[model samples]
Target: MLLIRNLIYWLLVAIVTPLFFLGLFIGAPLPRRTRHVIGESWARLLTWLLWHVVGLRYRVIGAENIVKEPAIICAKHQSGWETLALQEIFPSQVFVAKKELLWIPFFGWGLALTNPITINRSDRANANRLMLEQGTNRKQHGFWISVFPEGTRTRPGVAGKYKLGAARMAKQLDMPLVPVAHNAGEFWPRNAFLKHPGEITLVIGPAIYPRDDVGPEAMTRQAEAWIEARQREIGGVGPFAHPDERKARTA
Candidate 1:
């Protein structure tokens, strides 16, 4: 049954959706918003398909606090699920990710159309410079840019260090920093082929603004601490809790 669901979903998704996008790109008079709407629907449809295929479901909390702002999203990157899910929920999203992801087959081409803020992961100084550049550009373009401050996906119950990139962008752009947290790893963890049946909660807190007196270090710490607390409230240990894992029981 699961295999059947996966097959049908991917057959339509992998073949039909891109073909539709291609058709629209060629001669169709579809507006950019229309294309984005179709992409959003596709994300939700696939998410539902995958859930039913594996009998997995999830919930979100405090999503109301997220406003449509020209701001930076300091998200906790745990598993790749929330990235697509967030963009689906908010179609005007401008994702600032490592430029390496541009190599993905279908997705790479799609993002180029919207012109996302891609950064070179190879050069540290260069990447930071590029981050600020793209952040400012996305702001001017009126796209809400999301930055995963953790830099990389966290192991279940293990939070990675918060980088200064997100804060720097917020300061440079003078935009509020919206903090997003999700307990996705318990269900769709990093490098796991078999997705498990569980509830994944995406809890988005309100935007955190930089104080007139504080520096980047202060902004990073506050955003990191808030998300970490939210993660703990959802039943797992805080991101800092590497406190001796008991073999990580797959949820």
Candidate 2:
């Protein structure tokens, strides 16, 4: 049954993605707000497909922690799920993604239209410079920036080293840093075919205001502690789980 549902979900993607891409071109030459609305609409459609086609549901805890004003959203990277869900959750936000993603055909063009902060991950120094430079400009224009501190998707029960780019951008811009933790990979394993039907819990922590004396590394450490602790509380299989054991569970 799960396999059938997953097939249906991908079928839906195949049908809808091209249409969304066409809409992107139509919205081109219009204002950035117009393109953003189109992108948000596509995200909402995909989120709905995830629920109806795949039987996956989600609930956001501490949504009130999400302020209306522009701030940095630091979220866990697990599956492709958050990429769609976050767009629906936070409207008119820019994501910090890799430069390679911008080279894709239709999806990449749409992403570029949204004015995301694309970085070449290979060059650490240049990436930081771009994040600080472009991130500040985006924030000044009242756009929220969503960054994945781990940089790439990590399997459930695994935690990646938290990067300090988001923290630095927050401090540089003097914005509130909102940390997010979720176990989405438990249901939607990275690079896996089957997506189990389950209610994913996304917890948003309180805004951490960076102090003048506090540096990015320190601020990131503080956020990392809270996020990792919260991950365990929300049913993350800790590092103690063996690789084979984890694989069997996913299988």
Candidate 3:
């Protein structure tokens, strides 16, 4: 049943993705807001399919934590699910993505229209400079910046080394730093073909306002602690399961 569901889901994605890319191209000459709406509409469609076809669902907690102004969002990287899911949850937003993503055929072409702050990840100094500069510009244009501080996705119950880029960008712009945690990897395991049926919980922690006394390192640490602790609370099986419970079950 899982195999059947996954096969059907992928088939739908394959058919629908290119169609949306065409829409993106048609909307390219329009305002950034129109192009963003076109792009995010695609994300909304895919997330809807995940719930209806794949039986994967999600619920957001602490949504009230999201403020009205443009800010920096630091989210845990778990699976591709968050990429699609966050678009629905947040307002007009752009991601801090690697430049290589703009090279992909249809999907990448569509992403390019979204006006993301694309950086060459290999050069840390250059990337940081560009992130702050472009992030500030985007914020001024009323776009919230979403960053995966881990640089890459990690498995469920595993904590990735949080990078300070998001914190630095927030501090540079004096924007609120919002931390997000979720258990999507538990159901949508990274690079896994089969997406299991489950309800993923995404928690948005309170905004950490940049302080003159708080440096990027300290801000990053605070966000990491909150995200990782929330991950443990929401995690179900595998490493997220209580050690004593697993031991007793094995015994």
Model 1, 1-251: lDDT tens digits are 65565466566567766764574355235555555555556557667766776655777787687776677878888776777678755537677766877787667766555457888877877877777777777677677888888878887667898989888888878888888878777666687655555677788888888677988889989888989888766645323233343223223
Candidate 3 lDDT over 54-150, as tens digits, reads 9999999999999999989999998999999999999889999999999998778888999999999788778878888888889888999999999
Model 1 lDDT vs. the true structure? 0.71
Lowest lDDT sum, 10 consecutive residues, model 1, at 238-247
By TM-score rank, best first, the candidates go: 3, 2, 1
* Decoy 3 TM-score against native: 0.93
Which candidate has the highest lDDT of all?
Answer: 3
Stretches of candidate 3 exceeding 4 Å from the true structure? 237-251
| Model 1, runs deviating above 4 Å | 1-12, 20-35, 236-251
Instruction: Pick the winner on TM-score between candidates 1 and 3.
Output: 3
Clashing pairs in 1: 159-239
Per-residue CA lDDT of candidate 2, range 119-154, in tens? 997898787787889988888778899999998998
